[model samples]
Target: MTDTERTPAAATGRKQPFDLGTGPGRVLVWFYGVFTVAAASRSIVQMILDFGKAPLAYVLSAVAALVYGFITYSLVRGGERARRTALVCCAAELAGVLIVGTWTLADPSAFADATVWSDFGRDYLFIPVILPVTGMIWLRRARTA
Candidate 1:
């Protein structure tokens, strides 16, 4: 192909740097995706089976599922804007986890059932708590990459 026809990155002979699909990012995406499915499914079942039992916890679970879904989508999109969006979402996810985790611990009676973030995701091996931190670190590094 002629130089004029070459893509900018190709013309410069520099391969495009990896985004969320490489190395640890790939793992992060997988975790987010899994959480999206898990949280969403759990929330749906809980809402259907026991909506009046723990409305707040169930609603929060649904929200967490949505956040996880968005983060997963952004990571897969793989662009500067996507990375930034994912970073912000990750921060929000972390905050949610911490707040909900503490709330559950402080007043167990408030939640008739556990959310995904209950006790810092004790039901899910604490992955919910750790995932955001890992995602934040990965996003920061990807920004520099």
Candidate 2:
């Protein structure tokens, strides 16, 4: 029998592809894309409005935005190099969240305004805290292919 005919599972939906691009991956990609825009805009507005007030925080905001952008791009590109870049960015994101979260919590006065990493992304319902971990998991899964 042909490959398709040899598999009785074909009678069911088991023959279908995982639909990575259209399903979970699609949601993940969209989330990264939205964060890219949101974080970029936030950094630009903060820097333009009063970067002198907190140069370090503003610069870190920009870095976060860039990382989010890179993650979004890598997810859409879907390849070996892209996977590696995504993995690196995700790890960096995790570090950023942890460091910034601790710093902000320990010294709230240091942060005059909210940042993406502030309060562990409390403003965004902690997605900012959890996204990198999820991204890392997804990146690992993609690597097996």
Candidate 3:
């Protein structure tokens, strides 16, 4: 299959992009899916139990969840449009990580608790910071593949 050619899925006859959900996209899908679940779960639990303690942190985590979920969905639903949307989302996610990471660091007392992007994802091994960059690179390459 070529970049502009889409092959029908065996079971559904739905056309899928030739370049997406293959090698690097597959890895991105996995990581994004995992991050979606992780961020969503953490935010949900924190909001329900201790939102009063750190509302900003919890809300930011939830926002990250929504972003991750959208990107994951876009990756899985491959098409030219989806790829473009995912690339844009990856850029937004990268900005969020950097901004939130710096905010948390500059004013540690700003949050009573840590968000997924806290200290550049210190508790999560900085995957929050790294994943978006990888995703953006893969997405840009996928556009030409």
Report the candidate with higher lDDT, 2 versus 3.
3
Rank by lDDT, highest first.
1, 3, 2
- Write model 1 residue lDDT over 27-79, tens digit each, in one string: 98899999999999999999999999999999999999999999999999998
lDDT of 2 by residue, 17-129 (tens): 32234456788899999999988998999999999888777888889899999988888887677888888999999999999999999999898777898888888789998
lDDT value for candidate 2? Answer: 0.84
Q: Largest TM-score belongs to which candidate?
A: 1
lDDT against the true structure, per candidate, is 0.93, 0.84, 0.89
Using TM-score, rank the candidates from best to worst.
Answer: 1, 3, 2
Model 1 residue runs over 4 Å out of place are 4-18
For candidate 3, the 10 contiguous residues with the lowest summed lDDT are 3-12
Residues 1-145, candidate 3, lDDT per residue (tens digit)?
7633553364456544566677888998898899999999999999999899999999999999999999999999988999899999989999999999999989999999999989988999999999999998888887776
Predict model 3's lDDT versus the native. 0.89
Which residue pairs in candidate 1 have backbone atoms (N, alpha carbon, C) closer than 3 angstroms, thus clashing? Answer: none
Clash pairs of candidate 3?
Answer: none
TM-score of each: 0.91, 0.82, 0.87
